[model samples]
Target: MESFTESLNRLKEVHENEVRGLQNKLLELDSERCRDAQRVEELCTKNHQLREQQKALKENVRVLENRLRAGLCDRCMVTQELARKKQQEFENSLLQSLQHVFILTNELNRLQGENEKLKEEVKRLQGPRLKPQCREGASDPPSPLLLPSPGARKAIKEKTLEGQEEAQDDHPEKSTGHRTSPVAKISPSANLPETRAPDVSPQRISNQLHGTIAVVRPGSQACSPDQGPPNGTP
Candidate 1:
């Protein structure tokens, strides 16, 4: 009976130790589960934050895209309007140029006609005239002396006066039929359509509107000393 009691006490001690170890393992497992739960909660919080950030980012991207599209559309409209205005201006300029060219061409044709008429008149006047005796010797009966019509005489006198005036205006000196000064010749380039003088370069077009004339200011030097001799020199 004493041996059996001792063996029972030993068995009790082993069973108690096994129970304590199991309890400790259970506690450890509980702690590990708590840690895992905390980690999961942290991951969930991070995911929520990330989702919020993504939502904000998407909203910002949408806003930026809208603004960009609006800006692009506005810019396109501005560009189109500018192009339209430029095209209108160009067309208006072209129209004005055509009108100017037409006027110049008409003037040129009229002048050319006048020049041809003057040349024919000059050729007729230069030809030899028949003497009175030579007309008498002709076998054909003499025609009546046909005096120039009053209107014809008046027209001739007017033309002569106009020519004299023009000559005087051109040469300010005793009229020699020969041209003393160089004739003002228009260059072929001058016949081109004229445009509004570029605002930045007015001098390039100055010669087109006004013939070449030497402009001198009050204190400026003259082109030739001969034209502006010493104060008392003849």
Candidate 2:
């Protein structure tokens, strides 16, 4: 009975040691769980702070964008107003220039009409005396020998000399060539008075009257037969 009591006491001591070791392990696990809970709470707080900062940054950016758009619109309106003012000034200047040109054109037309009237008045003043002279010239007989140009007179003289030479050649005994040349020379000298006379003809008188009619204004009177001659003519 004493040995059995001693064995029961040893078993009781081993069981008590195992119970103490299990109690210590349970205490260590409870301390580790408390530290993990504190770390999880700190992470949640930091995430909430970061989300609040992002919201503030987005609101500030939107305000700045709105201000920038308003500034650009104001500048555009100012530039368009300036362009419209310049266009108005250019149109006003063009209108003034056109008005000045129109006034100058009217002045030029008035001066041209006055100049034409002055020319016609001058022609009328010189027309009356010219008509009487032309009428007197038209009454004279026409003569081919009374040519106005020196070249025509010279050519006619040459033809007359050639005819005289031919006649002298046909009648050689009637006159010597040397004597006939002196007669031809004397004949020109005798006709010098007639050559010096005025070259008056109906054609020349008609041409002068036509020129006077063309120069005289339509308002002037026509020439009359009863009109007196000029002081220079008979």
Candidate 3:
């Protein structure tokens, strides 16, 4: 009977300990549910603030798009057309300048070629081989013969006349047979040297002598001793 009573007491103590363990488990579950509910509330507040920010951003985007459609599109089109025209004008001017430069280059090349040709021609003309040919083609003119001047011719004629006067003086018979006039008796002098007068021809001397003889007529007065015969008498 003592053993039976001791076993019953032991069972009763185990039941009490099990009951305390279940109560502690229920308190832990309740604390976990309360923490979950507080976390849900904080999440809901953050979601509401994010929705408000999204709506404000959408409104701002819509206003900006409307302004772009109203005036900005036309302004951009006009600016694009002006830029295209300026670019086309620049291209045309560049093309014209290129053509002008090409023309000038061609002219310069032609001038340089002509200059080279002229230089070669000048060198050919100045060569030594051409000198003898030029001299042969253009021969030197014959030299003129030297002749006596007018003063020398007159002195020769006077010397011839004096010689003729001396010849007349040597032949007195011929002088007496003649008119004995000073002009008719003229003859060359013996004291003068005998020399040939190349300038005075024989025909010219004979004509002068005949002219002097015919000029003195029988009744005409003789000329003065100082005066000489006129040249036109011949």
Q: Pick the candidate with the highest lDDT.
A: 3
Q: What's the CA error at residue 159 for candidate 1, in Å?
A: 68
lDDT of 1 at 94: 100
Q: Please give, for residues 1-234, the per-residue lDDT of candidate 1 as tens digits.
A: 999999999999999999999999999999999999999999999999999999999998888789787776557779989999999999999999999999999999999999999999987876545565456556555344334345433433453454445555754333324331111222322122322222212222223222212221222232321132235332
TM-score for candidate 1, please give it: 0.30
lDDT for every model? 0.56, 0.54, 0.58
Best prediction by TM-score: 2
Clashing pairs in 1: none
lDDT value for model 1:
0.56
Q: How much is 4 displaced in model 1, in angstroms?
A: 1.4
Candidate 2 residue-wise lDDT, 101-141, digit = tens: 99999999999999999999888887997899778767755
| Residue lDDT tens for model 3, 1-234 | 899989988888888889889888888878887887778787788788888888988997887788687766657879989999999999999999999999999999999999999999898877876789668645754233233344434544664676466555653322223122222233322112222222223343454433333333333233332233556343
State each model's C-alpha RMSD to the native. Answer: 29.8, 18.4, 27.6
TM-score of 3: 0.27
